[model samples]
Target: MSRLERTMNRYRSLRCSGIADELQELVAHAEANAVSYLDFAEQLAEREQQVRERKRLAGNRKRAQLPPGKQLEDFDYRHQTTITKRQVHALLDFGFIDNRQNLVFIGPPGVGKTHLAVGIADKALDAGYKVLFRNALELVEELELAEMKGELKKKIAQLTRFDLLVIDELGYLPMSRQARYTLFQLVHAFYEYRSLILTTNKDFTDWGEFFHHDNVAVPIIDRVIHHSSIYMLGGESYRLREKTTAG
Candidate 1:
């Protein structure tokens, strides 16, 4: 008998996890000239390979780290009357495209802005693009830290490395003069070089207020909007629907 057969016999006597019983039955069959150790070993190896494949896929699923409550399949394209389903599908496809153009999703709060943004970002990841998602406020904080440590340039370079940088909220906070300057510098660096997805409640005309003044805002807006596809999303608050339904 081979080492595998010896091990199986020992395990059979110990009766571990019922594999022993199963092995015993197989061994009895083998002894009766019915089963072969090579076949059993091949089956065991195949099962192990399947287990490893499952673990690999699980890790990929988790690392993708998509939005908590949104998925491509879950998007209600049927109710989105203004935008055709074909256009929405095209937008999703754009996320995977390699031209590296900018995309903007403008809409009011709770209108699935983040949902579509995240959904696209998830697609980008699958297409082998590196993506970074953060709110404008959080990005400001990171810039602040970088400035304090005298590593602002390095941090800006890091941000530029991502294939897609998603800024979740725009115009939510009135940025200070310094933050405004830093944001402009960041935008200027990526001018026509990388893709960005910006979600904002305010339209282009009102984006100046986000800088707390017009002077700094106009240039950034001009640079961002120059070569971008803009999508105006209009819909009732999806969150409100959940609340009403729950009530």
Candidate 2:
């Protein structure tokens, strides 16, 4: 084989798939442009870097399981007046994840709580952080199953692996003793170490009712909010607005 073909094979073997795949096209572009050797090398390196970044983000998105097409840009701040555009833009910077902080979005149903959470989560995903989006019931059920299977530790370890975890629709269902304890344990596992974004329809005062009592609720709320930034959203329901406009 030719020397260039051999080099391409070497790049492939080195796991530089980007360079290997774009080798010929880049070389042709360099030749057509009559670029200097230094410029050609820079272009090649830049292309490989871009490809690697794209792959990294693609893998992050796949692992995150973020909702498709739910992005910060699409969030209707005009309708979600409580969640200000300024605050949302600030979150897009994703410094909270770096600081290992928590974000809580509390509001009634359909007030764009999950949308904002998902939007922040999308930004987190883009910012090179591992993210997971699961509803409160789903998370509780997983914890319950883990306890039943005697795999609670392992599950907690896995859950804590993500840089950010977005738990949506919290308090929509009442928690049993096991579920409440499990939820507490899960939060405790990640507390002060990783970031979490929670969206719930219930207020902090109503958490006792949602968790079924005050005694078990104190530690859970304390740990989560002790280091959290709470944004109490108040506004008309976005879903209703959409439906009304469509009608």
Model number with the top lDDT: 2
lDDT of each: 0.75, 0.89
Off by over 4 Å in 2: 28-45
Per-candidate clashes come to 0, 0
Q: On a 0 to 100 scale, what is the lDDT of residue 227 in model 2?
A: 75
lDDT of 2 at 243: 93
| lDDT for residue 115 in candidate 2, whole number 0-100 | 82
lDDT of 1 by residue, 65-178 (tens): 555766666788765554565766787665423666777888888887787888777776665566778788988888888998999899999988877788888778888888
**Alpha-carbon error at 38 in model 1, in Å?**
25
Kindly list the per-residue Cα lDDT of model 2 for residues 18-46, writing each as its tens digit. Answer: 89999988888888989999998898788
Tell me how far the alpha carbon of residue 69 in candidate 2 is from the true structure, in angstroms, after superposition. 3.6
Q: Which stretches of candidate 1 lie over 4 Å from their true place?
A: 1-65, 95-97
Tell me the RMSD of model 2 versus the true structure: 2.2
> With candidate 2 superimposed using the best TM-score fit, by how many Å does residue 140's alpha carbon deviate from the native?
1.3
